[model samples]
Target: MSRPFLKMNGLGNDFVVVEARSAPFRPSEAEARAIADRASGVGCDQIIGIEPSDRADAFMRIWNADGGEVSACGNATRCVGWLLLEASGRPSAAIETEAGLLQVARAEDAADGAKQVTVDMGVPGLDWRDIPLAEEMDTRGVELQVGPIDDPILHTPGCVSMGNPHVVFFVPDAEAAPVREVGPMIEHHLLFPERANVGFAQIKGRDRIRLRVWERGAGLTKACGTGACAALVAAARRGLTDRKATVEMDGGELVIEWRESDGHVLMTGPVAVEFTGTLKDRAA
Candidate 1:
């Protein structure tokens, strides 16, 4: 059977979405790798599968191009939201994933009639066990040395787990942080057992922050919505900024608000439709 797919981007973090709600299929690591191949298969940073869920929302299965199955993906979630909205005609929707349940709503551009989306990125997790560090440490500001760059501009980082682990360092300049130089090192640091996404965040104002990220499975992506939310949570935990702020990335900007009433991080951004195609065998 020919499977339908959609190519979408959320602030430039692109994804290839496959709908498998009825005829459920789970791809193996090798299969996922082949499907995500830019040259051979469908090119995408991540491959998202939408399946039926026992919960109120649909289930989201996220896979990296490398074929690794991850618990969560923020940008991909937006892509799923867009797809669900198109199919159901509803303005808002709920999606389930291994990480947890997420509430998503439509964000329409009044001027151009383009569709943007907002995701309720559930509460950020603090504490050593939550961040799941190798050893118990202060998550508010953990020390990570970058070899010779001991006096490195980006030293201590505030860590948080938004389903996925992230380490955010407040830097003088987002561009100044050795993103390429130290991103890999910090990601593979001994302290982080599951590895981590590294981020350098520069506070532009009380309500704005600029950031750069080196994702865990994927390298330097244009944008990482969860990373942005994590950055905001880290910043708030350190008293550097308020709960609600705007995070600017290479692709664009997302408005993030760590709701004080419930602690759920709300991420608002734009989602674009590049095109759609049908693949033979669908799951083959």
Candidate 2:
């Protein structure tokens, strides 16, 4: 069958969103992996499917290029928000993912012709147990030894859980951080029991930060919405930045606010339409 999809990107974190709300089909691990193959398939960092929901407005299922299912995907969630609003003619939306329910919206005069999407990423988890670390330690500055890299700049990490695990290392320069070399090590570190998306962040000012990320299972991505949100939370926990700040990534930027009143984190970014296509002879 020919399945219709929406090719979208939040910053440069690309995704292929399939509208499966009607028929309710779950794409298998093999199929998801095949569709995300850059050389042989549609090529995307992730594949998202919209299905019926029992608890929230709609259900969102995410799969990485490696065919592994993940709990949360911030970039793809914004893309799904845009698609749902366009279909329902609504400005506000609430969608469900493997992690939890999230609120989404279109910022006024947002970039990309008002295609900018703001997601209420909910509250961030600060406790080491919440981040699910192997042992109880200060999550605000967890010690991480990345083999023989032997750089004090990369040893300590501020861990936070935005439904998913993340380790944020505050560095002097976002560009100079060895994200390509040390990211994979920290991602699979023993401390992070469940593994994690690693982020290198530099606080440019009281309300600005620059970031780069190595996403779990997906390797290095152009951008990571959850990583950005986690970075903001980590910085706030370390008292390095204000609760509200703008996180700049290689692909683009996101306005992040960790509300003092409710402790919820709000991430605002743009989701762009790339193109759409179909897949045939695929499993049901």
Candidate 3:
């Protein structure tokens, strides 16, 4: 039997979304890899399965391109939220992910025809135990450095967890950061027990930052929703930026705010539907 899917993107981080509420669809590791393959499959950064939820509107299951299942995905959460809002004709919606329940609402549409949406991404985890480093270390700045001991290329990365662990290194120039050289090394570094997302952020202003991320299982991507959220929280914790900032990435920009009142993070961004199709050759 054939399965239908929706191709969606937040910023430039694209996904192949499968609605599994009526029929459950749990892809195996190899199957997820095949579905996310750029050459042979639907070609997306992640594959999202939307299953029925008793706690929320829907349950989101996320798999990275490398076929590793992850707990949280901020950008994908917004896309799914938009779908629910549009379908239910409601002002807000809730989505249950492995991370937690996220609240989403409609926002003003972008001028470029891309739909804008806002997602309440829950609170960021700031403690070392929350980020869950392999050993005790300051979450504000961990003692991990790349390159030579005397003159390290990158050092003292701030860590945060949006369900999944993330490490953010502050750099002078985000574009010039050696993302390709050292990103993969940090993702599998001994410090992170569950592996981690790596981010290089350059503070542009009190309310602006430029960032690039090497996602744990997806490698370098145009944008990462939780990556942006983590970057903002880390920056605010380090006194580099305000509680709110516009995170500019390779794909586009996301507005992230760490609410002082509730400690929850809110991300506003654009969602684009590229196309829709059916999977005729699903892997068993």
Candidate 4:
């Protein structure tokens, strides 16, 4: 049977959302890759499946463009959260994922009627074992370097887990950082046993930063919500930024705050409904 789907984006980090609450819709890895291919199917950074959950309002399953199932996706969470809120006419919703449960709520809408969402991403993981590096090391400054022995363009990056592993490099200029070239290398580096999302951040101020991310399995995208959160945490750990900051990405901006009281990361951003349709030839 053809499946109805919604296309949504949060700060240009787009998703193809499939509701599987009643019927199971488990796409094979190859099928997911095909669906995410820009030239072949409905292109998106990730594919999200909404299923029933006893612990939360819904269960969100994430599949990257490469068809690999991952534990977390913050931008997609905001998109799905808005959908749930709109459908239930409620102000908040809880979504379960492989990573954990997320509490999402509707914020004030934009002047143009654009919906806004805030997700409680929970506490970030700072321990070396939590980031799950190949070996134990100081997460604040992991022993990784790029470039020549005497001089390296990128080195001693801070590590954090915003549901997924990430290593953040504080660069002088995010635009000048060689994201496309060095990102893949760091993603596949041996230090990160589970691979990792690579973020290049430039601190503009204590409350502002510029970021570019090389998402694992998804390459470079317009924005990465979790990456932004991880960036803020890493920056704070390194004393480069405050607990809260506005992260500017290629797509737009996201407001991320690491709540000091609860130690949870709150990400607030705008979500857009691009379009909706059905998959004519459903994957079996």
Candidate 5:
């Protein structure tokens, strides 16, 4: 049966959202890869499946462009949240994922009529056990380095788990950082048993940061919402920045706030609906 789908983007991180609440739809790894291929099929950073949820408004299933199923995706969450809110004409919605429950709310719309969304990413996990490193160590400063031992280019990165694992490296300049070269190395490092999302962050100010991320299974994306949240938390924990900051990414900016009182991280950004179409086959 042909199924309808929506193509959406949060910042420049795009997604192909399939609504399967009533009609069941699940794509295998190879099928997901085919659909996510830019040249062959509907191109997107991740393929999102919106399913029925007993505990929340809907369940969000995420598959990276490589067809690997992951626990969470913050940009996809915001895009799905906006769709739910617009459909229900409500102010908020709850989404269930492999990571956990996420609370999302509608913010004031932009002048261009695009709706803004804020997601409660929950508290970050700072323990090595939570991040599931191969060995135990202090998450604030993990023992890892790259480049020559005498003069390492990246070293002592902070680790955190925002649904998924993340290792943030504070750099002198984000634009100049070797993201493509070093990101894969760190992601597959022996210490990170489950692999990790790598973030290169440059503190522009107490309230601003410039960041680029190499996402696990997805390689380098235009923007990574969870990476932005992780960067702000890691920056604040290291005394490099405040609890809240505007993270400037290659695609756009995201406002991330680590709430001191509740410890939940809030991410605010805009979502855009690029177009709509129908898929003749679930795999295609």
Candidate 6:
């Protein structure tokens, strides 16, 4: 039987959302990869399953394009949050994920029919073990590099965990960074046993930063919510940028704020519906 699904995106990071509240939708790794295939299937960076949650409004399950299940996805949370709010006609909604529970609410919609969203990503993890580095080290700038022994192409990245691990490398220019070449290298670096999302961040001003990310399992993406949050935190910790900044990515931009009061990261952006369809044998 075919199951219904929705195609959604925040900035340019896309997802295929399946409703599995009543009936579970657990796909095998191969099945997930097939569904995320650009040519043959509904292409998306990740697949999200909205399951029933006793603790929150819904339980969000995330799987990258490579079919690996992960704990968090900030962009997907906004998309799911919009759906829940529309369904319940409520001012706010809470969604649960492997990473933790996220509180979401509508920000402000635009005249162009775009839905604005705000996601309370909770507190970021800064400790060595919080990011789960391979060994003990200061998270402000981990000792790792790529290139020559004396001069490296990239070095001393600030680590942060917005549910998933991310390492932000402050660069002179974001566009000049070899994202495709260096991203995989940093992601698979021995220092990160579970792998990591690699970010190339260029601080444009005290409140603006340009960033590009090579997401683990998903490779290079237009936008990464957690990566953006991590970038802001990393920048703030390094005194490069303020606690709040506009994180510009290839797809678009997001307002990321490291709230000083609660230390929770808030991601504000727009969510869009590309289309919707049915996947054959929806695992219902």
Query: Where does the lowest 10-residue lDDT sum fall in candidate 5?
Result: 275-284
Model 6 misplaced regions, further than 4 Å: 111-113, 282-284
lDDT of 1: 0.87
lDDT of each: 0.87, 0.87, 0.93, 0.94, 0.93, 0.94
Q: What is the TM-score of each candidate against the true structure?
A: 0.94, 0.95, 0.98, 0.98, 0.97, 0.98
Candidate 5 residue-wise lDDT, 1-284, digit = tens: 88889999998899999999998778899888888899988888999999999999999999999899999999999999999998999999999999999999998777777679999999999989988799999988899999899999999999999999999999999999999999999889889989999999999999999999999988899999999999999999999999999999998889999999999999999999999988757574
**Tens digits of per-residue lDDT for model 6, 148-190:** 9799989999999999999999999999999999999889989
Q: Where in model 3 is the C-alpha error above 4 Å?
A: none
Task: Name model 5 segments beyond 4 Å from true.
Answer: 111-113, 282-284
Give residue 283's error in model 2 in angstroms.
Answer: 5.6
* Residue range with the least summed lDDT across 10 consecutive positions in model 1: 145-154
RMSD of 6: 1.1
Over 4 Å off, model 1: 108-113, 280-283
Per-residue error for 167 in candidate 2, Å, reads 0.3
What is the Cα-based TM-score of model 3? 0.98
Candidate 3 C-alpha lDDT tens digits along 1-284: 68899999998899999999999888889999998999999899999999999999999999999998999998899999999999999999999998889999999888787789999998899889998899898899999999899999899999999989999999999999999888999999888989999999999999999999999999999999999999999999999999999999999999999999999999999998999998755652
Give the lDDT of residue 135 in candidate 5: 94
1 or 3, greater by lDDT: 3
Q: Write the per-residue lDDT of candidate 1 for residues 155-248, one digit (tens) a residue.
A: 7799999899999988888878889888988889899999999999999988999999998887888999889999999999888999999999
Model 4, range 107-143, lDDT digits (tens) per residue? 9887777789999999999999998999999999999
